[model samples]
Target: MNDHAPRRANRIALMIGHCAGMIDLVALPVWVGTLITRYGLAPQQAGLLATLFLGGAVCASLFWAPRFQRIAPERVAGWGFGIAGIAFAAMTQTSDYGAMAALHALAGLAAGSALSVTHGTIGSGEQPHRSFAMAGLALAVFGIFILGGTPVLVERAGGPALFKVFAAVMIVAALTSVAAFPRRQGATEQGQRSTAHIDSTVWYAAVGISCMGLVQAMMFSFVERIGADRGFGVAAVTGVLVALGIVNLAPAPLAALLERRWPARYVVLAGPVVQATLALIISHSSEFAPYAGATAAYAAVMIFTHTFAFGLIARLDPGGRALSATPAMLMIGAAIGPVLGGTLVQHAGYTSLGNATLAIATVAVCCFARAGRTRAVLSEA
Candidate 1:
């Protein structure tokens, strides 16, 4: 058995898979904006549309991840990426909200499958951390592309044209996955079957991840609206998102450094606290410079939290299925978050919405802290 072959194939799959994931996310805000502008969707309806995508992802992951464990993971991933690409292409032709929603849901389902299979492939390898780091790097680069380039693309190409471009990208990613991913013999041959029950530690990690997702969804969904309400223009909002993407790119290496120096638990706990403080500061200040600084801070904290929580779950679960399940749980919370945040914004405005997010962050920090302590004590015992 050539060990290097599987590992190399896994790395390639992770990079392509994460690129696909980012394309899905990058399309999200733009899709919501399209629904609002072209279809005259209310903010709540736009939020719900985002929620529907996430909800579909959650359901698909929960039902489909285990089945992939029984089938050929890499082939499943290839098919998923292809389906997602086709779904993106279909978006260019649809003006009907129901049709768009259904297609987006299908896209979400495919995204979930790709994510699960990619993680499963990476997790099967010996040096999972290195694989995860590579995956994180891909995510950061994709974020940079989406944040920095999407606005320009939208301006130059228009919405339909932008979808066409992304469709092309997705098709390329799908084709690459098919070429690069190795054939898995079977799920059982790859590893042990994952028991379906959620461990308490994994549950705590899931909560932390979900809270992180909630904060992120709120930021992505309303950051522009908040900036506009606070007297900044569209360019400023795009600038902040781009800055956030840059900050997200910086943290993968920083997370590697911190992981070398400190325990994963400490990094996980600190991230939410930092994010909460930044959110609180942003809630109080309406100034553009201060808000931008706060937004950068929020971005850094979110990157750290997301990476740490994901790493922790990967480490805690001996069975790699936890990788798939953790993200699924987080996506469920993400599905719920934007709708709730939009309601708060509708009734109480952006500041109050920020406050609500801060409260959630605080609770998340406490939960992570408790879980960390419990893990420490068990290790000592």
Candidate 2:
């Protein structure tokens, strides 16, 4: 195989696919907000609708990952993008909240499939790290879309039209992926045949990833609430989130450097520990400087932690496409975290929610530390 063949086309397709996946999420919060206004649903009910979307993703991922392994990765990814687009397009015609929720769930399912298939393809490639780096770059780009694009789209086109646009984007991405990705022989024909066993090491990585996801969900969902509690305006709250995203862009390079010297586990563990500390500080302080600093630290920690977890998982299961399983598990955790954290904030306030996040981060650090040590010893042997 020409390992050094032009991956630009494939990488671009992958980026587009990921962006399509991300656009679904970008559309969701605003869509939910619109539903609330249109239907006058209770806050909890609205939240449940959002949860259903993520819950469907979590449920589908369990089945989707294995199926992707059974099918050609490229085909699975293309179909995923296509399905997502179709689902989003369907959303434009729905007025019933129930129908909308189901459509969102379908979109989530498609996104989950796309995520697994695309990541598996990248992992199966020759230079996996570069592929991962490209994935990260895609994530960063989509992060910008999530942060800035959704609101603008909602304002200009309204929710239904916005979803239609998102659907069109997914369709384009699916076509590109189908054209760009290499054709694989067959599912059973490629990779090692290992039983679908969840090893302790993988579980540890999952837990770590879940914790990181929880922290991220809390930050994204509640940062504005926390800032408002501290007497900051909406713009100030947005600034904190924007700053976090900007600062987060730095950790990919930092993680690459750290991977050369330190084991992935150590770096992973350290990220959560730092994040927990920052969470504590953010919880206690209302000052603008301190809040900004805490947000930046939290952002850096999250990026490094995720980078380490993904890298470690990829390294540990290099023989097969098992790394695809990690994203599904991670997405499940991500789905749960926001719902749980949002509930906590509603009842107990931002301080309590922050404390809860810190506690989760602490547990993650311990789990990752143990796993890191074990991995190091195994590597040495």
Per-model C-alpha RMSD? 2.9, 3.5
- Model 1 misplaced stretches (Cα beyond 4 Å): 1-9, 22-31, 185-190, 193-198, 374-381
- Report the number of the highest-TM-score candidate: 1
Q: What's the lDDT of the predicted structure labeled candidate 1?
A: 0.68
Instruction: List model 2 lDDT by residue over 30-119, tens digit each.
Output: 444444444566434555655666666666667755555557767777888889889889988877877977887887787777777776
Superposed model 2: Cα runs more than 4 Å off: 1-6, 22-43, 93-95, 155-169, 185-190, 193-199, 228-231, 281-284, 375-381
All candidates' lDDT scores?
0.68, 0.64
Give per-residue CA lDDT, model 1, range 1-381, as digits (tens). Answer: 124546566567668786675453434455555556556777787788678767777876787656645666667678887887898799889767788788878877886677677766666555555556667767777777776777677667666665676677667767877887756654342365366454677777777877877776765566656676788887887788788777777776677656556677787788877766776667667789888888755655765666666666656664567776644766777787667766777787777766877678877887787667655323521
Give the least accurate 10-residue stretch of model 2, judged by summed lDDT.
23-32
Question: Deviation in angstroms for 92 in model 2?
Answer: 3.9
